[model samples]
Target: MVRKPDFKILYVDDEPKSLRYFKKTFSSDFIIVTADSGAEALDILSDAGNNIGILIADQRMPEMTGVEVIQKARSFAPEIVSLLITAYMDLDVALDAINGGHIFQFICKPWSTDSLKIMLLEAAQEYERNRHCLILEQKNRELEESRRTQERFIYTLSHEVRTPVGLSLNYSDALLESTLSEEQREYATSINVVNQSLLSVLDNTLDYSMWESGKLVLHEFPFKLSDLLERIEQAFGLQFKTANVNFVLKRSTEGIDNLVGDPDCLFQVLVNLLSNAIKYSAAGKEIELSIEILKSSDRSVDLRFAVTDTGEGIAKAIMDRLFKPFSQLQTAREGSGLGLLISKELVTMMGGEIGVNSEQGKGSEFWFEVEFWLGSDSSDGEEPLNGSRTVEGIPILLAEDSAVGQAMVDGLLSPGIQRGDR
Candidate 1:
């Protein structure tokens, strides 16, 4: 069924007889409003412009021409579809007006009722299309503004958080080096671990923001696959051991050892997977890491790495959105909910595919397959600390704009301050 159009059709002419005839012809099909002159039509439009969709005006009026009235009416209601009616045989003026987009259609002095009705129908459809397009443009602008606002908020929050977290970590390290009892040392270590976790959350949140804004870039370098796996094992070994979860790593084939890729990104993906496994698995359960040689050639090698956890498996319904940003399946645990999302994006950026297999009762297996070219020169795979260094007994200058950040830094470094060092 066709819905009735709510907008009215406006007809303007210098002759009262033509106005009457137009209203009498189209009154049943549309809400017809008649004006006898261009000036009067402008007045009607100025009063009720939004309700008028189509404007049909006669040319050669005493006060103004149809094109003049249409050009002016467009300023008030830009979505109105305009039509020109003229009896004079001069085509130059009509052509100019049509080219200027002041008119949608031109009708001769003696226009057939059926053809005029069809033209009005087309004009109504055009008006609707223009309205819809305008709405979409407005919505897109709003969405872009919202995204920018969110990015700004995330950046500000991350900066505000990092200052204190960094100071805490530095102070905790100093405390660990100082003399203390076994219980005191344990307490300080716990504090340092918790602060490191907080710092990790902040870093992950910033990385997620970068990915959302399309600013994350991958840096490639030559590295040993075995070295990368060894680093992953070293990083998570203590955590898994403390949790009593068995951590296993199956080495890659001998031929596919050295490869060219982003070792930092590869290690991050593995760490995220292992961390999740450790977090979800129960004590005494097993968490296994294995690498399989999917395909190997002279230049490139494809390796599939899987992290299997003998923990409570995920439901089928939640599996689809498992990798979405801020989507956490186990809400009981504390997390930033961006680890899986960042891992997925990092894997894809490195020309890889990641997936998960799980059942309600059975455990979950998360795996990724990535291909890397075998590097020509052998690399020791010893990663340099990316611009990180420590210096002792050197007077350091700290510049922090926020007063709270300045106080936190001062408190953290007070123990190292000598007499008259203020």
Candidate 2:
């Protein structure tokens, strides 16, 4: 049998003859190191503790007892397996070694070679087991500390960054309500879009953290599926109109109007899909959203929602990691990279499966299938009027640092401009 590498056996005795005999007998089976006294054994340990796996000390030495040496050796390499060799069977010494927590076995002076070899093999195995356990324990502690640090950083970012973003959104909304020229309207719209995008990034970051911490919860209630689609159309209709892209929503042959589920989460997932479609597709490209009812019963209905886009299709390699957090494909446009990850998590929490199918040049289709409870009544299909068209006559104050933003604000609030020198 091959001996274990780096497993050194240290034999300590005041008598040189005993030490020499022990080394000569066991030198072939193990790396035997001889020490004349407790001091010499400790000196070897201090220099080669990492390589020394088993330490056997003779009792009744000149100055230090075996128990004392073993106890002191533990300070240098606490994981070393220790043994006590004695001619006299002193019960007190045996008890002391047993209770010290370091000694693994006690061998008499007249030990058979076979018995001593077996005990040493067992002691080496024990040392390895203890060392592995300590390594694993330390790894667990580091992981826990890292998680806590990430939690604190996310918390601080959410609180500190969102305040100004919220203020910018409100200011943009105020500007949109006021009367302005066509060019001025475009500028205000652009500003509103930028602020909204920033707010979206913030929201995605917060959602990712919540999901990672197992703190995200779903709230279910009665809602109309048709009404949800209508809201999505209104939200993206204006965006597509400005971008000159074709946006279509198709209902399946069999449609379910009323359902009981979390509307907010459903809306978020759809919005993320639509936003990506818009961001990646070139002008004049077509984007379509569809809903198909797969199965229906008295209590529940299974629906599959799909978004197909005629953009640059995802590569096979990129698609593999599409839903991973903070992972993004190389593109000219910028994104938070958390949208798809959050969308996948939300779909899973609602007991649904989300996936994507794409080809190199043929574009892509993303879909999710979820089951929801049937509602009591059907939807009326009444659409709400646009709020920006109705709300007017509110005096707005715009404080913007950027020149373009200031010009947009000034154009919106013309004829009431006041100048002050700085």
Candidate 3:
């Protein structure tokens, strides 16, 4: 490959006629800078260190040798490639210089112009390669530091804001449950909705930061597929109804019911797909989720989850950018543009693959397939509730610094405690 004259070559010799001859020989092919002595060569290197890509100097100079000149130039311009011009008798010293890393190669006294041009080109290419690696390494270090900073910010923000959001949501729930007029109940419900949205944003941010820092982890536990579907239907069924969309959850549950996996991550992935479907869909549109059993055995099972929506379908132009971080199909929506990317990451971490099928004017289907270990069968034909083991008789001690946080925790745990489930 050939590059334009972006780099310069510096040649040094004590003979003025030789310097002139060298420049005229390759003046059209390369950018050549000549120096008559070692001192002049060092001065040029000092001023144009970055632009000079290759350095070639005569071994026998007036004050200092070419090896000394190249070694000194390397102190400030280590990325430059160096070659020695020597006679037959100076071959031994040139060999020492090459072995000691003072020069890259040596040329004989009566060098062929074609051979010398080829050597110079190779030297320039070597300099380019080294410079490219240095730049790439620097960029990687910067990216690593940025990821660390983002992780720290996510931690600090969550620690400070979680209590307040939790308090607001639980208090709103409490207020709605108490006796109140219709308007008051509606206002409390609105507060609950807003707080839930804020909490979702916070969760997504924290997940993205953890993923960037390679700290995102998935926990495995046993859960019933029916319960998982029930929770999702209970959570988003009303949202679909309110939007006047026909929503259905089709569960193919004949294969396996009890499985071990990360429920939270699977839930979030479904939620992201459903949320996007809700945004582009209009009234009277159709949205459906299908959970199909693909393969099953006594030890493990593989299943496919798909979300289909009849909305203004994705355009062909922007389809490839769907899963990229910070890329959105539509700029008018409200989001960090990380939902699809986060889903992809979570699905991959769980040993699954995600994809989409869409047309310009038709609807779209987003699907993923994952494998889960089968849980041990229960003799009583009963599974643990949402992956939580039995802790009915255990004494529990809760701790929190904020009163609001304590109240929220107490409110959340009271129902389970009353039912003697935890």
Candidates in order have lDDT scores of 0.83, 0.81, 0.82
lDDT of 1 at 221: 84
lDDT of 3 by residue, 276-314 (tens): 787678889889899988888878888999999987788
In the range 301-326, model 1's lDDT, one tens digit per residue, is 89899999998888888889899866
- The Cα error of candidate 1 at residue 311, in Å, is 1.8
Q: Give TM-scores for every candidate, taking all chains together and pairing residue i with residue i.
A: 0.66, 0.63, 0.66
TM-score of 2: 0.63
Superior candidate under lDDT, 1 versus 2: 1
RMSD of each: 6.6, 8.6, 7.1
Candidate 1 colliding pairs, count: 0
lDDT of 2 at 173: 59
Clashing pairs in 3: none
Clashes of 2: 0
